[model samples]
Target: MKIIYRNNDRYAIKKLLLDIGEPELERECWRRKLHKPRRINLFFLETNEGITSLKYKYPQKGVETIIDVSQYDLPECGWIRYKIPY
Candidate 1:
């Protein structure tokens, strides 16, 4: 997945997800300690059905999550790509 920002930490990602009603994902992120200096990569894409999916991987914890955010209204930044991350 392509990272929107190289410096984005899990704290920022969790806050955004929580604000968007993704409490489960937010809780899951805290399952393990990401003490490394490396930041986690957050990947997002809009599906053909117009649903935007956000995904992230926690390699150290062996976990990953995908969030369907079609119900929420996301601000327009003129940078969201519809392509799915591979």
Candidate 2:
């Protein structure tokens, strides 16, 4: 899948996972890192078929990450709405 993060640039999900680990691991890391004023927010964009997008919104910017699900399999955890606490 294609992820649009930070400056709305597109990135491959496989590459991102390679850099950051799995989704669960990434969420755990993010939860630990978000002990300050700044934070990142995650959201699952829902659609009739299933989750069509995954968004990560940063403090200063809008969505820092966006995963397009149309062409990829959903994560093993399944599609659930998430907003990682800061």
Candidate 3:
């Protein structure tokens, strides 16, 4: 699917999930390095072709990241929200 981050004009996702070493608490030093402040704020343009969901699985860490990008249906709002670690 075609995904574009509204904040930037790029047509693809960028700088997401740099390292999945171990689970770290929110606001922790390790976590900060994993997901930077700018990377976490994802707002996609509201379109039919927008992303519906995003899933990432790390077997070693036994961590599964699942984010439903379509739940917050803001009709005509012109944006689809998808935050990291959701």
Candidate 4:
């Protein structure tokens, strides 16, 4: 797992997990915290996945943060990849 910290920490987790490839996704978990500079955390449901922590200012007054998480089950390869979008 890759953990990235950014001034806009909200996008860090999303950037970290986007590499994972998933077929479909269901639920999501989100959090806002009081850290050095404030941030957001998100966890995707239906895949037992979690985005540990994020530190970013909620969009001041712009477009919402768009995040997409998915799950891919490769029966033949015996593996599952979860793709989290930023």
**Among all candidates shown, the one with the greatest lDDT:** 1
Supply the TM-score for candidate 3. Answer: 0.22
Q: What is the TM-score of each candidate against the true structure?
A: 0.40, 0.30, 0.22, 0.19
Candidate 4 local lDDT, 44-68, one digit each (tens): 2222244322123344532233233
- RMSD (CA, Å), candidate 4 to true, equals 13.2
Clashes of each: 0, 2, 0, 5
Give the runs in model 1 whose Cα sits over 4 Å from its true position: 1-15, 26-40, 43-45, 58-65, 78-86
Candidate 1, residue 48: Cα displacement in angstroms equals 2.9
Instruction: Write one digit per residue (lDDT tens) for candidate 3, span 1-86.
Output: 33433322223323222232123223343432433223333422223355543333233432233443454432343344444341
Candidate 2 wrong stretches, greater than 4 Å: 1-16, 19-51, 76-78, 81-86
Candidate 2: C-alpha RMSD to true structure equals 12.3
Residue 9 of model 4 has an lDDT of: 32
lDDT of 3: 0.33
Better of 3 and 4 by lDDT: 3
Candidate achieving higher TM-score, 2 or 3: 2
Cα error, residue 68 of model 4, in Å, equals: 18
Clashing residue pairs found in predicted model 1: none
lDDT of 2 at 28: 53
TM-score, structure 1 vs. true: 0.40
Q: In candidate 1, how many Å is residue 61 off?
A: 11
